[model samples]
Target: MKVAFTAPMKPLDHPVPSGDRTMGRLIVRALELAGHKVEVASTFRSWRAEGGEDVTREVKKLALTHAQEISEQWIERGDVPDVFLTYHLYHKAPDWIGPYLCAKFNIPYVVVEASRAPKRQSGNWALGFNAADAALAQADQVVALTNSDAQCLSQVLSKDVLTVLPPFLEEARFEISQSVTKGSADGTIRLLCAGMMRAGDKQFSYMVLAAALKQIADLPWRLTIAGDGPARAEIEPLFDRKRTEFIGLIPWQEMPRLYRSHEIFVWPAIREAFGFVFLEAQSCGLPVVGGRVFGVPDIVEEGTSGLLSDEGDASALAQNLMSLIKNPHKRENMAAAAVENIRKNHSLEAGARGLDKVLHAALERHQFKRKAHGGR
Candidate 1:
């Protein structure tokens, strides 16, 4: 099967490195791994970070124009895709192309990691909300990245159309020695965090982490943050300069080594939609500690592979951190479990298998429906 993929939030090859881009690339890779030919449908981003009605109107118009052109070109080349797949569609960045192309070509439409916010039905994001709702309704199958997202989507989409596919990693990319030891040689617990230091949720997560670290000041641990962004100046002062080290923006290839070197992966993960870092860290055999909110718990099995504290609760987060720091035995056990958990449940092969099943079902259902409608 040939799949036409589009990510309205951010293109898969976007120059800036972000979790969104990473997930987009992962989806493309997973589809290819499933033996499907994947083509990126468009690079036109529809994300509107902050805008009024006029700004959104212009973006929608531009998106529709791009979609029209792409459809015409594909038709001219006699190479329309068999399936249309859109990733990460929400009110902030609704897809305007996939549905149009799928309708024009009479192909199966699938949406992955789609979230629907009913509250945006009549607000500044009303246009985007409606557009996303329409796309979801038109989808032959909607793949939710987490149960939380699935629940929200169920409000508007049928339960039959919804399926939960957890976030996954390409395990082959991270090669860690099975005999590698946890923590540094001098008995210092090495904690690592990898996230862009931006304002809003990222900055707030940093503040929460800083507060948690302050509570465990007496513990024998050192934190190394591996990311950089505009809010670094504000985020830096929140932590003790001596105990914390900031190594800005480690390349993607080097992240696995960084995770292997650390004993624990810590991130407050405020409002996180299932962080890929958690999967990456665990794949490298490192236990994780994150706030218990949204999809964090989906990846980090509490008391099994990692620990979770209540979202934004510095005290609880601190206690979770201290528990791991004080008990090297527990950390080592969780580290082993983390690696196994990802291998069994979140590996690229697992995701590829899941996609193969879902995409094939979608194609069959689409054909059945079309036949029922007398080929429309």
Candidate 2:
């Protein structure tokens, strides 16, 4: 099978990539691994801030122009891919030509990691949201990254069925050729947090963690935050007077190494579809401390891997942090368990196999639907 894939949220080359970009790349590789060819039809959107608010319009125009080119290619190319797979269509960046081109080419149209946030039902985001809804509804198969996302899609679209394929580990994360320990016996506890500081991000949560850890400022523990974002300026000050250190954005190549330097990984976000970083941390032999809600529970097993506190319960979060800090033996056991858990459940090869099953099912359904229509 040959597949044409796309995503409007961010390009594969975006500076600080998200889970969608990671998943998109993984799926393309997975299809290729399954003896299929994939051409990434995704293009445009550097997302640079050249002239403030005008940049949004520029990104949209570029996306639409690229979509037109892709449409033309689908028409002229003698052999269209056996399938058209789209990923991460948001209200901000809707897919305009996907449904039309895929339908015209008589190919299986499958969407992965698509969600409908109906809050943007009016005004500026409405058009893109509507486009996303239409494209998703027209798809022969829809894949939701988590059960929460599937519920959201069900609330808005009258789709036949949606499949759930959660975030899986990247290939690099599976190489446990060496052992990594959390921290030393001298009372120093190293906690790490790495992610974007976007609009709905947890830049403030890291800040709050820093504040709570202030009670143990005299202890040998350190707070090292990775990654930079627009909200960093606002939250950086909050970590200033404490033992927190901001290391800025590290290259993806260096993430596993950085993960090994820390004992406990902490980032309490409000809600996430599924945090790939949590798995990344676990893969690097670091147990996590995060919020109890959202799709996080799917990744973090309480007590074994790490602890999850109620959202906004700063007191409980601090307590959890102190628990690991106070008990080095527990931290060692948790670290070993985290790496073992990720290796067993979330390896890239395992993830690829899971997605292959979904993609093949969608392909079979497309063939079945085509045969039924032709018979009539």
Candidate 3:
């Protein structure tokens, strides 16, 4: 089967592999690994995606152009393929072209990792919201990343066919990079919280963690944050730059060595769809310390790879960090478990193969429906 893929946050040509791009790339890899061909049908490769007057106009224009280009590409290639698989087409920007082509061809339209924040009505968000809601309503199948996401998507699509698959990621990138300067385990602990500094992703709570940890000055620990976003300006001044290492936007391929050097991975997200970083950190043999936000409990095995604290509770997150900081034996045990969990559950081979199963299932379903309709 040839799968046409689309994503909202990922640029079709962006060289850097950030979270959304990585997911898009991994999903394409997964389809290919299953012996199926994939075509990235539609994409918006602009940094001006954030809400504004001009961005709204640009997104609409881009969506229209991309849709036409994809339709032409699929047509010129002789066949439209068996299915169309899209990822993360949310309110910021939806692959308006994908739905158009699918509707015209009367083919299966599949959406993965779609969500809606209905209240966002200003500027580009309104257009994104409208596009996403329409796609959710039109999709033949929706692959939800978590149970909660499935539930949320159901509210819009009113469909019960959403698959509740564990969020899959390529673990190879999280391997110990030789570039990261290794730190001696000389009584001091290292902690890291990685993710975009988007509001409500827990960058706000980092201020609280800083305040809490700064109180324990004699603890001999280093906390480094690796990410950048609009919220950085507001959040950066709050943390002590002298002690904390703020490495802005580290490449995805080199994050593993950074994880190996750290003792604990901290993510106190107020709300998270699924923190893929938890899997990355654990893949690099680092224990996690994260908030029990939406879908996070499903990702982090508490007391094994990491401890899941209550969402937004910086005090509790700080305490959990301290416990791991002092308990060397426990941290070491958890680190081993973290790596093993990745090997068993989140490896690239396993994830890509699982993806194969889903694509095959979708193709079979399409065939079955076709047979019932006399190959209509």
Alpha carbon lDDT of each predicted model: 0.90, 0.74, 0.73
- Tens-digit lDDT string for candidate 1 (1-376): 9999999999987888988899899988999999999998898899989755877889989998999999889988999888999999999898889988888889999999998778888879998888889899899999999989998988887766788998898998899455555577789999999899888999999999999999999999999999999999999999998988999999888888888888999999999998889999999988999988888888888899999988899999999999999998999899999999999999888899988888997898799889999997
The residue-by-residue lDDT of candidate 3 on 73-154, one tens digit each, is 7688778867787787677766677687877776777877777676865554776677678887777667777777777776
Clashes of 3: 1
Enumerate residue pairs that collide in model 2.
none
Assess the local accuracy of residue 59 in candidate 2 as a C-alpha lDDT between 0 and 100: 55
Compared with the true structure, what per-residue lDDT tens digits does model 2 show for residues 26-73?
777767776778888765543232322345456557766776777777
**lDDT winner:** 1
Q: Which stretches of candidate 3 lie over 4 Å from their true place?
A: 15-17, 45-62, 118-127, 156-160, 176-185, 197-202, 228-234, 368-375
Q: How does residue 348 of candidate 3 score in lDDT?
A: 65
Comparing candidate 2 with candidate 3, which one achieves the higher TM-score?
A: 2
What is the lDDT, from 0 to 100, of the residue 369 in candidate 3? 68
lDDT, model 2: 0.74
Best by TM-score: 1
In candidate 1 the C-alpha lDDT for residue 124 amounts to 90
